[model samples]
Target: MAATGGSGRSTVADLLAAGMAADGASAVVLDTAPRLTSPWPSWTVGQEAEGLAALPPDRPLTRSHVRHAAALRPGADRPDWHVLTDGRDWHSPPLTLPQAPAAWLQLAAIGGWQCVVADTPHPVTHDLLQSRCAGHIGLTRSWCELPYAVPVLCASATAGGVQALQQAVMALHAEGMPLQRTVAVLVAQTDGRLPAVARAGATMLSARIAAVVHIPHDPHIRAHGLRTVTRLRSRTRHAAGLLFHEVLAAAGASWGTPLPDAPRPAPLAVVSHS
Candidate 1:
């Protein structure tokens, strides 16, 4: 989640989901932003395909239904990491799509996505407030409460951006959100230049969040807008790896009850060195 755009929100979402898929997990990136502006279909084959909006939110969505609706990754099979977003054009008729967090959870549950990375829309602080008041559970809160969900907060690497990000983080903390498991990513829009305020902000934020990682601006991503992640600079990939590791460390715990027994060392050989 991010306070605003240009925060690398979509980039972060794509990286996490794609990385998980490459690691053999069933991952899906859910686009919650407006259809017209969403980047999910930017370079994939989903530009003109039926997407999340086409699925019948009122009825159960099967794997086949989801696969048919999604925009598959490049060189990926049906079951590989897919992106679910809008497929409408300017002339297309209006469509009804689910926006509530619960609705998305249901979709993910039915689709059986082992990992869901959502690229949310603007004004996340407002969303956090809306979901907390008057007995409402907004998308932000619901996703935060997902079992073992590690939230990745993004902000541009700038003074103004970091200040705004700090405010958003404060709001989330006031809402009792999990800062311990959350990771903050400072996305450098310019290469080899990070503002002093952003650096200081990261230092302060490090005390409150799980980890703070910096993503160097990749000229390729800037030019292509996540058209393909394979061409990312090695440094960018390394930073993404750090973000992934921090999230995994935060999730290091049993899934639930009936937990499998912890591995015990085999009894030492009883031959007594015989």
Candidate 2:
């Protein structure tokens, strides 16, 4: 009965929801800005400025606004603030993670009390997965996942491409992105690019990350991808649960908590994502 935190849009939320469902718990998703912000189509310059003004002072918000606001700097095209609040004259300061109900919900949902929390701030969709380890709850020592945040330079691929991917990951890491956030990378298999990514990732992120999966490229395989997507999604989720259990076991070894090996859950359907 412990809680953990994660940061993201749909990806983290989706995975968290799946985890909550699997564990029969609840998930409270927090947005970076007020929920009443403008829709995607209305995300123009003036529109965003207006949207910022329209943000609610106390409601949860998404990080999109902050990222966008930062983008509007001298050489930027937009701003990047999760939620914009009124200045000196406003009723409240601004919305932030601490103000969001998700934190409390996670605490209540897990053990009926506060326990653990995780977050990552990368803009392209990525987060730290380490903070979710089950055994670290209420522990005095916190495990850092720095290597997982580093890029394992691949020789087969263009330095620029690998660098870009690495930059994206680093951005997420520096931004305090959640650990469970999944990153998508395009690799040239014949060139050993996948291995490079894995090797580098393993070397740099071994302590924080669990495993690196290589998904084959198959164009025709996507014909019925939605179903497969659903299945693979389930598989990854179960894998996460397994990871949680492993953490618990490790923690038990030192804390005398007497962790038990939970029964393996049924395999999820595998779908082709070409």
Candidate whose TM-score is highest? 1
TM for candidate 1 is 0.84
Q: Which ten residues in a row have the lowest lDDT in candidate 2?
A: 71-80
Query: Model 1 segments beyond 4 Å from truth?
Result: 46-49, 75-80, 129-135, 253-274
The superposed Cα distance between candidate 2 and the true structure at residue 18, in angstroms, equals 1.8
Question: Residues 162-227, candidate 1, lDDT per residue (tens digit)?
Answer: 987898899889999888888888999898868888889999999998888888889999998887
Give me the overall lDDT of model 2: 0.30
Candidate 1, residue 45: lDDT: 43
Q: Candidate 2's residue-wise lDDT over 57-161, tens digit each?
A: 444333443233321111011111121222222344444433333432222232221112232222231222342344332111111232112111111123443
lDDT of each: 0.74, 0.30
